[model samples]
Target: MVTSQSTESRPSLDYEAVIGLEVHAQLETESKMFCSCSSGYVNSPPNTHVCPVCLGMPGVLPVINRKAIEYTIMTGLALNCTIAEQTKFDRKNYPYPDLMKGYQISQFDQPLCSQGWLTIQVDGVDRKIRLNRVHLEEDTARLVHKDGPDGERYSQVDVNRSGTALMEVVGEPDLRSAEEARLYLVKLRTILQYLGVSTGNMEEGSFRCDANISIRPVGSQDLNTKVEVKNMNSFRAVYRALNYELERQIRALNEGERIVQETRGWVEAKGITVSQRSKEYANDYRFFPEPDLPPMVIDRAWVKEIRDRLPELPDARLARFISQYGLAPNDAVVLVNSKPMADFFEECVALTGDSPKVEPGQRARAVGTWMLGDFSKLLNAQGMEIRESKVSAEALSEMLGLIDNKTLSGKMAKGVFEEMFDTGKSPGRIVKEKGLLQMTDSTEISGAVAQALESNPDAVSDFLSGKEQALTFLVGQVMKATRGRANPAMVNSLLRKQLESRK
Candidate 1:
């Protein structure tokens, strides 16, 4: 049982964590890497999608998936990697229950892409994490562990995912903390999603990560023995696992225990990493050129075509959001980090037309405020993504329009927006059905202001004596009396008029 020590209880040490990550994203190809087997095997029954080629049957020849190669190159270009004009596949000899072929055909010395870097922001500082290589490989089958009725543990092999195209993004050890590692993963995942090469969903095992972490004295120039941590399926898990492993290493070093170079599994429930096996070196796999498949000669025209066709990435979109929408830097960063959210934001902005009443920049800022404020609050409370929300971009724009036209107060619109999110109803329909229209009528607002002043004589007296806060109390009274339907500007104006007449 592994336990985590709280920061307050842990001893302070002059150490810094050196972390690197190997992320495996299963490509969104239609078929397996070397076979025609369907890659859409996530929902299929075990062993149903397997073919003789994926099974490594004797006398079976494997063919490469051209689309997977293209996707890998696209990913490399997106990461600013150097695409290799010549690349080949090699056999990685390994014995595992999940390896259907007893060896994987993967890129070894000659990867399709190498020498890339991505920028990640941590603590408001931008750091570029270097990429060692981005290589293509086939995924192994899954091992399903089950408990037998007689209290015995047994494992079964599911070959459905055996031959799926997998891209391994190996990062150099440039990270100094768990937070940096998490940010790096997030940036990389965002890039992958923008490229449309992978779903980048860690929960579904399409995007998986294995982290190598070690700690050295803060001023040390040498790298220490690192432990590879696996089984972390989420970003939060990765952060926690790395922090825990860092602390564990610090404690071990303090106690003069030798740090072993080994692979460990992150126990999510225990919040600690447990030793699994010794780390394997490249020679352990006995990598050799695979004779079954031929080398790939990528064309410069193809690379240029893919690069030209690349969509607007997160960083570029961030800058555009700031300049195009006139949004604040922080607000634009948050929106552009998630592609779906950013797309939804642009859609909402587009629906909000440029009129004298609502300028384009004003409309964009208003949409950003709502999206980053109450709309986000509700979505988070319900655990829904922007694309999965019941509220459409059109509906949100309509609600903002109501606010702009003074048909609904900001408070009233909050309720209307909540209803819109809940039932997927139009803003106009919800407003009409719930009688939540703003009380813009001067006569009606005057009456409410008068009643509030007559009832709250002490507040009125306080206002007469120059208490600025008294006016705020009276405005709240008016809003409450009108069930939050009164236009706030109208309420303040009417209240000030009535209060001045009293004085």
Candidate 2:
């Protein structure tokens, strides 16, 4: 594995940064990878979900789930990988309590997918990262430990997670920064959302990653003794782990200490990678062909169908939003990050031209703003998914339409949106029920403006005396007098008319 060496000369070892990531995503299939047991048996009485196949009991055989295979192939194509025509399961022998069968069923030597690439925006620059392989494997059981005060400790095993299909995507050592890793994950997770594969929820332990970080010279072509980081549960944790490992390796090399080639666990709270044990070799796993299951041969027609089924992915969608809707890159990223958000935005467009403020172009911008800005907060506070959200596209459009039609102030419309989300009622019903019709009529607005001028002669005098912002204060008072239902645009118009009359 010899390659070109680093050219940056320094007093110490010229170390550069190198990272490769292995992500394990739990497939959204109904059953476990190799058995008929349910995959959603979380929090059940530990071993209740276990069956003969998952328990490694004798006289029971495991069967391959076709959905898992399709999911693996779909994920492979999403990574821009060349799916292997022939693939199989291999036994990775180990003696851990979590591995009930005395070995873990995984892919080795010939995995299902390989040579894929993932492109991500790192620090506003698009970087294309290479993928080594994405393979299908079975997850092991849970290993929990309980201890008492007097050092009395016991170990317990739960087989519920056993046989759960997992896809381990191995990235090439092309990532240079922690930001790059996080961006790559965002891109990868978005694709999974489009594919309807994994939930990509790191909090649920469904999607997890391990980062391998090492440092070499700035211009180094040769790699370093990379250390694998485990137990990172989220994208933020992955970024933190790589940042910590890079600094740690730099200090070690600065002091002339060697970094051990081994696996380390990410201490998220402490923000460091703790050395776990000596490196486990490939031979230690004792790779062998699975005795029960046979090899998988992917057909051209099936592959063609999967390729055809892929939706217009995130990057492409983001570009379209930019070009078509004239949204900023950041706004486009936020919208396309979640499927429902993008769908909700489009639905709003169908209801109210495009943007909220203007007929079409401005309306899209307005909708994007509210959906990303205030509405996002409202949804988060209610702990509601956009699809499950009580606020319908029609309701939001009606609310924005009121504002666009000059029938409601922006502030009044916000109040309407809040009411709409809360009661699942249309904005008109809430407005009519609360008597919040905006005072946009000239007669009503003129009467309120005259009252404000007489009530605050000094404020009118201040406006005439050249303190122009005093007019803003006067207009605000008019709005307050009208119980916030008065249109600000009308208030400004009438206030200025009265103020100019005073002069």
- lDDT per residue for candidate 2 within 1-503, as digits (tens), equals 11223335536454556888888899999999888999997778888778899898877888999999999999999889998998899999988888888988899989889999978886687889999999988888988889978999988888999989999999999988787788888788888887889999887788888888887777778888989889988888888888778878887776667988888899988887899866454448779999888888899899999999887888889888998888988998899999889989988877765453475767888889989877999988877778887888888888888888777888888888887887899888888899988877888988999999999988888888899889888888888899998878778988888778778
Q: Residue 84 of candidate 1: its Cα lDDT?
A: 99
Which candidate number has the best TM-score? Answer: 1
Candidate lDDT scores, in order, read 0.91, 0.85
Q: What CA RMSD would you report for each candidate?
A: 3.1, 3.7
Which residue ranges in model 2 land beyond 4 Å of their true spot? 1-16, 149-151, 279-283, 353-358, 381-384
Model 1 C-alpha lDDT versus the unseen true structure: 0.91
Model number with the top lDDT? 1
Residue 398 alpha-carbon offset, candidate 2, angstroms: 2.4
Q: In model 2, where is the ten-residue run with the lowest total lDDT?
A: 1-10
